[model samples]
Target: MSHSLSRLPTLATAAVAAAIAAAEPAAASRAVQSRTVKINGVELFYREAGPSNAPTVLLLHGFPSSSHMFRNLIPQLSERYHVIAPDYPGFGYTVAPADFSYTFASIADLIDAFTQTIGVRQYTLFVQDYGGPVGFRLAVKHPERLQGLVIQNAVANVEGWSPDAVKQLAPFWKERNTETEKPIRALLTADTTRFQYEHGTTRPQNLSPDAWTMDQAGLDRPGNDAIQLDYFFDYQNNVAAYPAWGEFLKQKQPPTLIVWGRNDPFFTLKGVEYFRNLLPNATVHDYDAGHFALETYGDEIAAETLRFLDTLPDK
Candidate 1:
């Protein structure tokens, strides 16, 4: 009888361990997946998390950044929201064909195809820097596909752009000459990339060097500079689109949330006013950090994003 009892204890322990092991994979499945899919012959890289059935949140990164910017914010949202961040043709790990057009319109077209390929019929868009141009283009092309909009340091109104950016870009926007384009090249340096991530945040210490490390690595790749320049020249199209996007916002008024870094050097705080005026009902959350507000204020931003998301009328 004692022998049998001893065996029972060992068996109970084994059963308990097996149960624990089983639960681990479930949690592990929640981890973000780095994946790639071909769209128009380009290999697009993305990070996805949360259940396939959950409402989708499409994250669009800014200049010199990629889906990696959302690394901290993704897990925070993955439990309740399906989050996906893709590296545009000229950015991050995505591989573009030599013959692919590098204009913002073409990039948006591929992303549109990407959504169709992934079977995501609708989603909320989270846009930053370059994302502003890309996301706004997507929104204009197919306004029906937008479930909501989450704007982080992206502007639809040209008046919202910083004067320096507007001034520096004017020549390039007018004509891509050596004199005009030469100045723009300075913005592509590692120093500028690091500056964008570190300049405005309060917690400079915690911000990972890896953010710029990875972004600069991607930038350093052959022919990538020209890809970025094409986008820079193409940015004029996004500027011309301000009126249409503004009108769309006024008409659709999709549930809007604006999270900004007030201290940003590239994009001025004045830009926030344009959104406020257009989206009087839009919620705005401003942080003292720089361009990459999420780097230091992620917990706060994540909470605001969740609060904003829950209040949405539907998926």
Candidate 2:
């Protein structure tokens, strides 16, 4: 009887251990890693995740934001694909040298070098806000390197500009001066930062305050305002290249997916249609949220992105 009791205890312990193991979720194969690489004399900070051999999705962030914007989406996508989100010069943790030109073209050049240095020869480009200009520049420069495109509130057509945004940015586009900068400076305030995330959401209360808090913190950095202003003024150059970008899209017709926020005040819904007109085969998902759709619909965006990526020819 004693022998049976002892055996029962051992069996029970083994059963409990097995149950515990079963209850616990399997550990993820990889976790997001923050890294920095020297490119063009500046250290570019990037967040990377997923297997090196997996198809890569390069995320380019928008203005007043960084790779931090993709904090949630990276790990989700990394489960099945290699994801890279880099902070351009003058943004995020990237070192901005005084001599570094902050124009979209210059930043694009730096990002191109960054990808080459990191051995990312081919990737699906994910562009948002300021990322649109930078990523488009890369697309035009090396169309062969592009495997696909994922656009989130990124504009490539003049009609992408909201009427209000057009009026507000008129002065800066026409001329860069103290008087013209007044309205642009107003956009740099904390309140405006908060509004950018909360304005178009159905559940403004559900949005995390951290979104604006982190963005405002980045903007408050010394000389960042000047850097942003320079980029804002240089945006006119991007507008001028819209036709070329359109032509590239029409020619390459790379499998494209656009996840847009209908509530975005900056880029109009027309922007999504413009790409659709160019690449009729492109898949598009629209969200009720504003400029930063990922902030609100990250899970949905990640799921849709994975679905869209699966449709592409495997590299």
Candidate 3:
């Protein structure tokens, strides 16, 4: 399922309007370059930084956002860890066939294909938002491909959501109704993006305008709104896959770090507890931040992540 951008509300606010105007001139000045990779017939657009042979870190974004979400965090990490962030099919610069079935499992296959195509045999995985399901699917299929795991504001359990979001989706869980449910599915916009950052973070106003603008433009792209809505609907089944995901962790035991936004709106702090219990060797950090901790506390979180990596005796 795909949606046209016409359904998304246009940002006419003075602040947002001004940011877009300012970004236009400098957009060409930005140094990051993007490339297209074909996998299973889907064309994926991805941004790359750092040396190819450097320690690899694959970053995955969630719904209503893209690799664009990592605009700020990527450069910082690239200095140390070779970074690759791709816009999922139907999101960012990637384009999904109008008839494609946008399931989490399918996305995992694409991730695996992209990595192999790029000659990455092993690398760390960083997951956020929908990245939980998508990245986890990759983990389940190719646990050996993962070097380590870092999660920010991703749900490892169904128990991590706020009561409001759970309740809102409860009805659609029982029945399949896109027309009656589309509006609610389309609810995550700049307003909700702001809400997600503020409510999910310990500090909200620290967000950057460039980061916000990239998110807005990617979601505003034509035909993206529907894909987002479809993914929201697909998330209902994500819970069913959790038990197997947990089982995979128990069997594989990938060294894990939990960088959680203490105030995440969708996934509560309980997710930290869940990962801690599930992975005996996992280390956890709760930041006074929201869903996008990197946006609010990137430097601190990145430092913490590097510190954690350093503690690995073999690294």
Top candidate by lDDT: 2
Candidate 1 segments exceeding 4 Å error: 1-26
lDDT by residue (tens digit), candidate 2, 1-315: 998987998999999999878654322424888999998789889999887888999999997889999999998888888899999887889998899988999999998999999999999999999999999999999998998999999999888899888888987889889998999999899989888898798767658888788889889999899998989898899999999999999988989999999999889899998999999999989999999999888889999999988887976
RMSD of each: 2.1, 3.2, 14.4
Which 10 consecutive residues of model 1 have the lowest summed lDDT?
22-31
Off by over 4 Å in 3: 1-31, 178-183, 200-202, 311-315
| TM-score for each model | 0.93, 0.91, 0.84
Model 3 vs. true fold: TM = 0.84
Query: How many Å off is the CA of 257 in candidate 2?
Result: 0.7
Query: What ranges in model 2 sit over 4 Å off?
Result: 1-29
lDDT score at residue 118, model 3, on the 0-100 scale? 87
Clash number for each model:
1, 0, 5
Q: Cα lDDT of model 1 overall?
A: 0.88
* Cα lDDT listed for each candidate: 0.88, 0.89, 0.78
lDDT of candidate 3 over 105-128, digit per residue (tens): 778878889999988887788899
